[model samples]
Target: MAPVALIACFPCRHSKRRCDKSLPTCQLCIRKGVDCCYPKRRAQKYIVLPESNGVTKDTVPTGNDSSINRAGGSNRSSEWDQQSPLEVSYATPSVIQSFGTATAIQFIAPSIFREAFLEIPRINIAIPSEVAAHTGEFDQIRDISATFFSQVVIWTPVIFRKNFFNIALNPLSPRRTEGILLSLCMKLYCTPAAQDHRDGRTALYKATKQFYCEVEAAGIMSVCILQSAILIAIYEIGHAIYPAAYLTVGACARYGIALGLDKLLVDLTGENNAGRPWMEVEEMRRVWWGILILDRFLNLTNPLRGLTTKDPEYDDYLPVDDWTFLNATAKPQDNLKISAAFNLKMGVFTRLAQATYLVNQALKFVSSLPPPSDSDTVDIGKDTAQLRRTIWALISVTKTEFDAHDLATCCQTAISYCAILLLQDCHWRRVRISSTEDAYKHMFAESECVLQNLALLAICLRKDAEEGKSLGEEFPVFLMQIVYQGALTTIEMGQGSPNEEIQERVAQYKWLLQHLQSRWRVAGIYLSILQSKEAIMASIA
Candidate 1:
């Protein structure tokens, strides 16, 4: 008889396309939501044997039950039958190379896995010879460092400008960590200019890799290296490669824990003071804050993933004001005055950090609950009440300390507002699942809070637009996210209410979203959503 050839399943066969011949089912059938059926198989009796090439070939099992059982042929057949095309493609190679003791496939399996799962194609970026040749150029290093400090340092003040410049421009010796930081700094600084200068951004990216290799070669751990890791994470975030950014921050956190940076030092004497400079201790704290900010934002944006610092049980003090940090050797009284001068700025950063921390804590608490039951309803209620109180207190305090006109202050205010929406969304979901309430009064209140904050955001953006100030340069991506949420909230508030205030707020939000259309893609998306009167009216009704 002719050899029985493998055939496609019904779905693939009917569709007139190639099939992977997956037993029982195939990817196309699974994706198309259809039943997969194959033709009946013929019974055969054959043998299996292991070869000298570390390969195994199988034939149909013979009629001896004991022999079939001992060979475990049934289980092998079942596993093969269940295997997907991807799995089969991974395991069986068309050709294998044998070295003295090792058998190698022509292709690496992990690359195939990445291609299949992540769908991120690999692209090789050629490093220019001049970047390597100009590694020691003082002017080039200074220019790049200056660009970073001038543009990016205002938002993130972890690096001391003078000290960074001195280290990078040193002729006799240059620190590997500092070089790495400078490369990352250049990458971040060049990002905004990328639209105009793609080649420059590419060069900076290549230079960053070169510097990162140098840091790896040195294999030294210090505060500066930690700073380099943070900057690299920030660079990755700006570039919107979130998974890479997440991994970078995870590495930073682990390295930090190993170095005792996460531990709150109760004793400042003895080993702590023996040789460690005060500057180093303070810098470590600042770096910790940086890590916390990055971690919180990561979790906020991608809540489904594992968070690096879930609760941040450590008691590291918040970073001091910029002037106090810069004047490390200043007198206590002088530092106090500077702190007072920047107290509002300091409070804005600190309060936002605390709000983010509390949000994360609340999420962790909610996520830890057992699936809803009659007995758990009361406990959920109490927890929900406590969270509401905490959120309210944060909003009240932010209001009292509000800087209505400052861009950073307004940006954070928008976050505080958006958090209300997220909190209520969580609350309503659990309440409905638990069958606890038919109506939630808090939902209306939370929606109003969102509208108010969005109005405030609109005012802030309007002010900036009036002054011709561009938020495109230093605006955090999350601010655009806040704007997006605000647009939705405005629609919710204005839907059925014929109240003029509601209409006015909705119009203001629409204008703000439209104005930001040229800034970020998010703005355009929100603008389009708000522009749809039909959708808004339908949703409202």
Candidate 2:
């Protein structure tokens, strides 16, 4: 065999070991757990060139020659010997074309970018100094009052509603119990005073007129009835005091010849009245009667001057001298004189009377409930017991001295108690429902009603506070804190649900927070002003 030059070999073949000749797989493949192979290369066959008509004899290179020149001017090996390092250059046609096109175009002056960078100064513009100052003041005032009114209205309802709802749902709420007691107190004292006070009666009359007008505009006939009733009570009080102030008394008297008490009594009790079915109704009637009695007592001639110092117990039933023009007149047990005296004193008696009536009515209703035959009876029984206690507490307040300041306090206290009672009623309604779904529905409804009443109470309390009357010293602050805290807590807890109901509740809470902040701010401002005044006075002194 002819000796052949070794080209590329596998690792095993290079070591003089056996080659597997497995095409791609070799001996090394077995050891490395892989496949390896060599490719077949085709060999070129050499052909002797024939001398042709145009061929030259010296064209081909001879073997073992250093330099053999050919007709083509170079040998194949010489060409290989003349080879140098490879040179490479790159050109991007797209980029080059883009640059060429850009260069061909005319450059525009004041390009968008250039204009943006070289704008003229705005020095020509000037704002008036006064306008600027006014702008700042307007902004400050806007900021201060921006959320004030909105927060006031929104938060007032939210807090009141939440507190009312929670208390109403809570069968054992202390607040509810307290409310009942407070209502009783106001009925006994505040009702009578409010009935007699000319200012208070006038305010009520004006408020009622406004309420009626609004209700009529809205076409809410049900609400109109309530307003009318309130008006009737107001008119009755007015006529009992100053007959001159009772121009409408004649109109009211068309239903009845005297003060319309008989008509009111008939309206309150029908043939089927069968005693007070609802304690609230009875209490309301009692309040009405109480104010009337108190008003008549005040109208007695010289009652304030000690001319008619009859037995205090029989004051409600007695007729004193008719000193309408400050002239002494001997009147013999005149019913008109008795009625007039009660009217004069009605200012100090109205509120207390109303509160008393409401409490007694509530208590009477509770007492009228059938005895509980089962576990459900326990709840009803407890509510009735609590309600009675509340009524008694309210009634106890009536026995105290009736003064303006005391009367206002009593009203505030009574309103608070009424709020609690409403809450209790809501809670009981929830419990009475048979199913969870029904319970939730009833709960929400009752909650809304309780909330509205609570809001009204808050408004009343606010009005009382504004009048520079005592909210029982620490009581107002305590009540406010309790109500605010309770409302916030309920909102936080109730906001877990992602439903529409919960969303609305959260919105209400946000409104309440903003309202509270505004109120606190106002209160703070008031305190600051007061302090500043005191400091100035001290400095002057």
Candidate 3:
């Protein structure tokens, strides 16, 4: 037979392209976006092939028979199922090496500590050469102030998170930070300048404004840091100078308004309806208002000096009535009324307490001075007597409005303050004491008072909880827990002491913790009941 030629499909042959031969649209037609044309064809009948050899009709294989044999043997086929040379085991050598390198890098470059001490940029204020050239005393003050600012940066975030989450964040750390900052600020104010008053005021204004701005921007974790910074600025300005600028009522009002603290309070408590029942919000507002009032009183310009003032600008921003908003929003119930009245009364007492504290601080500062050799030891006995009288008077004022419950609560706060003072005094005395016995006695006495106050506070808290009163209700449970912890601390401090007073103090602290724990457990149950009721209502809705 002559050699046969294969013909291409009509579309491919016409377009001068290769045909795929298996589809309605050939590869060329599909690629070009043209319709594929196919010629009509009739179905052909299959014909059987003749035997290749005549060994036997059954042994001779035809084309169709070969195809059938190949199909039947497919299950046993090896050629199609063979693995390629490129195929490798699950654990490849290259993959193992790659993973090992990654693991080694991780071990070598641990990021934990590196990230922790990362430095952040901070604002730098230039001090004049003359100002910086002050005594070593000024350097010490600067170091303390700087340390406080750094701490504020560190702690601001922590406090914000705690407050925002309504968690039991410790106030002591922030309080300590604030104290240190305040001390530093006092030192700054004391640095004598040609224009001491104006310069001191300007420095204070700048520092306080910066502190406020930093705090707002820093978020919850930086709360302690910011608080410390603020305290530092306040303290430096208030105490550094002989006549403190911050001590004046006008200065206080100006500082408060400038900081926009009133608005900040609303911003903080307004979200999530934190101050629910309206009364709670009102109470908080009153607390902040009182704080502002105290701040103003402590400033250099006394707004309350008289109705008339030299500067009209000073009185422009002052709130018309400090307690009006609070009074108007208070709940009508007798209990809330009593609570509101007590809070106001306590607010006044707190101001007196602060004054007492300030006076004591001033006395201590004065006493630290070396007595003139010819001046007969510079007797401050009269001054000390007056301070004692003032303390008693303040205590009396606090007692006047106190019920059995409120009195106990007030005692708790007052005692805590006393404990802090005593602790500080003990630390100072440790360096100067001649008799260890006397020092131990004083320490034990202070520790005992702290425990007693905590016990009294816990008892009052329990009573209030039982009566469905709101005092301390919004405060974190950790606060109560810490009160118990404080008692434990006292007990621990008194252990292994030879003095009888110390032993008694230890015993009292243990008893206080035990009683407090029992009361707290009951309070927890009440909280659980309230939570369950809320859950039930939610489910029904």
Scored by CA lDDT, what does every candidate get? Answer: 0.50, 0.31, 0.34
lDDT of 1 by residue, 1-541 (tens): 3332377654464457777777657767778676655544534222232234657532322221110011112332332223211122111221111110111111234332212211111111122344434443556666656666565233345665545554455432223234435545554444542444422234565566566555434333455667777876765665544467789889888866645566522222112223344554555655666777677666654455677763654242455565666656522232122112222445344555555655666556655656665555534445556665666666665566545545333434555555666555555555552211232343646555655656776787787778988755555555666666665544544444435765676677677656644433345555666667527555545
lDDT of 3 by residue, 1-541 (tens): 3332234444454445677654555666677665554533322111111123323211111111101011121222122122121111132333233323322322354232122111111111222222223212333544544443333121111122222112111211212222222333433333322244433344543454454343333221122233333344333332233243233333334333333334423253332233233433333333334344234223212222331112212111222122333244323221122112323443432333243333334334443545335444433333343444444444455655655455433432443334233333434333333343444444433344445555555566565656777453113222333343454344334332425654454344344333333323323332344335434534543
| Candidate achieving the largest lDDT | 1
Question: Alpha-carbon error at 125 in model 3, in Å?
Answer: 31
* Candidate that beats the other on TM-score, 1 or 2, i.e. the better one: 1
Q: What does candidate 2's lDDT look like per residue over 373-434, in tens digits?
A: 45544454345555545444443445355332332234423333443443344344435543
Model 1 lDDT, full chain set: 0.50
Query: Best candidate per TM-score, number?
Result: 1
Task: Show model 2 residue runs off by greater than 4 Å.
Answer: 1-349, 363-440, 443-447, 456-541
TM-score per candidate = 0.59, 0.21, 0.28
Candidate numbers, best TM-score first, in rank order:
1, 3, 2
